[model samples]
Target chain A: MRNLTDTELAARVAQDIPDGSYVNLGIGKPTHVSGYVPEGREVIYHAENGIIGVGPTPAEGEEDLELIDASKRYVTPAPGAAYFEHADSFAMMRGGHIDIAVLGAYQVAQNGDIANWATLDNTFPPAVGGAMDLVVGVPTILVMMRHINRDGSPKLLRECTYPLTGLGVVSRVYTDLAVLDITPAGFKLVELTAGNTLDEVQALTEAKIHT
Target chain B: MDKRLPDLASAVAPITDGSVIMIGGFGSSGIPFGLIDALLEQGARGLTVISNNAGAQETGIAKLLKEGRLAKVVCSYPRSPGSIWFERRYEAGEIELEVVPQGTLAERIRAAGAGIGGFLTPTGYGTLLAEGKETRVIDGRGYVMESPLHADFALLRAENGDKWGNLNYHATARNFNPVMACAARHSIAEVRHLSDEPIDPERVVTPGIFVHSVVEYGVRP
Candidate 1:
């Protein structure tokens, strides 16, 4: 069956964002969403490290060590970019100023509960970065991840087993196989990748997807 | 009054055992490596360090954890890319780690600098991080009451600063330096650009009042 590549999925998420929207991208996969913004549609990027209007990656050998994104990936500033300390930066988030947040998740439940931070394993330290803040603060939350884990277990579930980053915060789930919305009634199918059937995708999902 | 320090070692001289120090940085950006090294030489034990990330590879907070001087760390993310030092110490029970949500951590430090006792925030509500904290529903949404996180000393890095302690941070490296400078009792700043004349007042991101001392660390790597 056909599936969307990571970039294509990011592109899909980018399409959903309205023009002039203020969006905050998570560290890894979600960062790619900024690069795929449609032409003529402007999106202001916010990095919790105290930057608004985060721009593209700087050319190699030109990285400003002091200047970086939340991922510390060494990014350039967009036009009209501004900087501030942590307080003002987070106020833009926790004060409900940001429009949307695109995050990577390990598990998402029918109630829109998200789990991305803690693995609950003793080997790795549990780190909860700005995810909690973004989920609770931002008006809309978008989760991007693969349809299933490496072991092939469903990430779309009736209830998330991992510790939640936020309770009932996720608005949409963009996976390789399909794009689904977490509604009051449960998972609602928005669309699917070409060559993917509802039965084929539903077999891999732990919860029932309302078509 | 002039607050320039002769050396990085002297900048950290006032810090002692049980000192709560805020190291300004996120990942490698804005980390005061020279001051962290000087603190290693100063050898104050049982310290509590606060920052966004613990350390990556062998530098930054890793140096302190390696010296076994730190008793605890209050941060949002203890492990960033190449943060093995934090992992080893955490697993061995050599360090106590208090992980706050990134924005909440920032706001708490900001609250200290801004002189507010405590504030209610929507972040961390109903999550494990808010387990023991007080919560209230405001306008049908849960908010957690977080207290200010003050520090005895704050180690910071900036792009430019003057003798009066006025500072201008380089790019994203400015992360927590400004707020940490305000929150600490005695804040020390290491700058890439240092001069005798004052920086343009309008251009100064952190005013002189917040910074206690300044040192010229010179250009970038």
Candidate 2:
């Protein structure tokens, strides 16, 4: 009965992130969550290269030269931060130690199949980085992205035509317009953008939505 | 003269003038500002450096650019000519620039670490980039051949590391460090925290065997 705004949607996603959770915020928009995490709550941020306990982006003059995130963006060090060889960071991801992996996706199938790495177009060749490892290793997968493509195509579909990063790995979808829970029954609309109607939202999505 | 490799640096010693080094970072992210500071403090001059991108003025690998310490550079881009001391030297015919495609640069470093002599890829074909490079056809696809590249020394950053030199990289800092470590004759790592033994071996990103030196100072701008 209640709708959420974009900022509210971000807060909802942030609210679900428990304290002390080790999270990998995928590149692009997912990186924005770092600034949204409620202050005073401790969350350990892991970059693929090897830094952890990352705080939000530093102010212009306050950045530490040695500290940065997987995106190569400058960051501050959280208390008790440690650094090590890079293989160990991937090992943590591969060994299923990371609790949450927040990623961006091009398409999410009804069965939670995620296709984020590549497109069908050969002209736009894709880069398959550590994303394959993340989907397989991270226990919880949270996808943060825009609800639709620039051409106004719905990214959430009954099936993904694009190459999949992993099958049935997405646990939740955080979009600009709504929050969704990918379930066995199909995509369940958990929350909608404020002032937007279910009919309007469903019209925008190609996938069937269950209230 | 002994041909065998010697022991690691016992303590923090100043980097000498005219040293060749490889910096680990993508763009400005993992540029090893602390090491740059150490280099600046040492006032090393006439250095040869390799990296992905020269950090913009006052950032990343660009600190060396600001210091005008480099005698030569090999990278993808030249953002700050004024800050890059070597660029002026290059114009004056006193420096060298070995430009490379971003992907090829990474692959070259990787090939060096993997012990491969050379590799062929389509990343740069039929361009000035292919000049003087070997070309081959694999499965009817043409690829420009490139040789493996190794460094005299490599500087890297990691998230958390154990005493054994096992490393975990923060997100973007994972850029060039892993590959550079493998290609370098000697590897020195800068980490935020150091763990005692009994570190979960599964969590190790880089093995201690590859690491010859450790700098425990956390990343400070």
DockQ values per model? 0.79, 0.07
Worst 10 residues of 2 chain B by lDDT: B1-10
Residue pair clashes in candidate 1: none
DockQ of 2: 0.07
State the lDDT of candidate 1 residue by residue for B1-221, as single tens digits. Answer: 99998889888999999999999988888898888989999989999999999998889799888879899999999978888888999999889999999888887888898899999988878778889898999889788999999999999999898999999987778888888999999999999888988999999999999999999898563
lDDT of 1 by residue, A1-44 (tens): 78899999999999999999999999888999998999999999
Please name the candidate that would achieve the greatest DockQ relative to the true structure: 1
Worst 10 residues of 1 chain B by lDDT: B212-221
TM-score of each: 0.97, 0.58
Reference-based lDDT, residue B153, model 2: 77
lDDT of 2 at A200: 82
Q: What is the per-residue lDDT of model 2 for residues B1-221, given as tens digits with 9 covering 90 to 100?
A: 11111111321143567766778875465666666667666676888888765565566555666667777777654433333443444546655667665446666777888899997766445444577888987787557788888877787766676666677666456667877878887777777666655347787777777766666656433
Each prediction's whole-model lDDT (CA): 0.91, 0.70
The number of clashing residue pairs in each candidate reads 0, 38
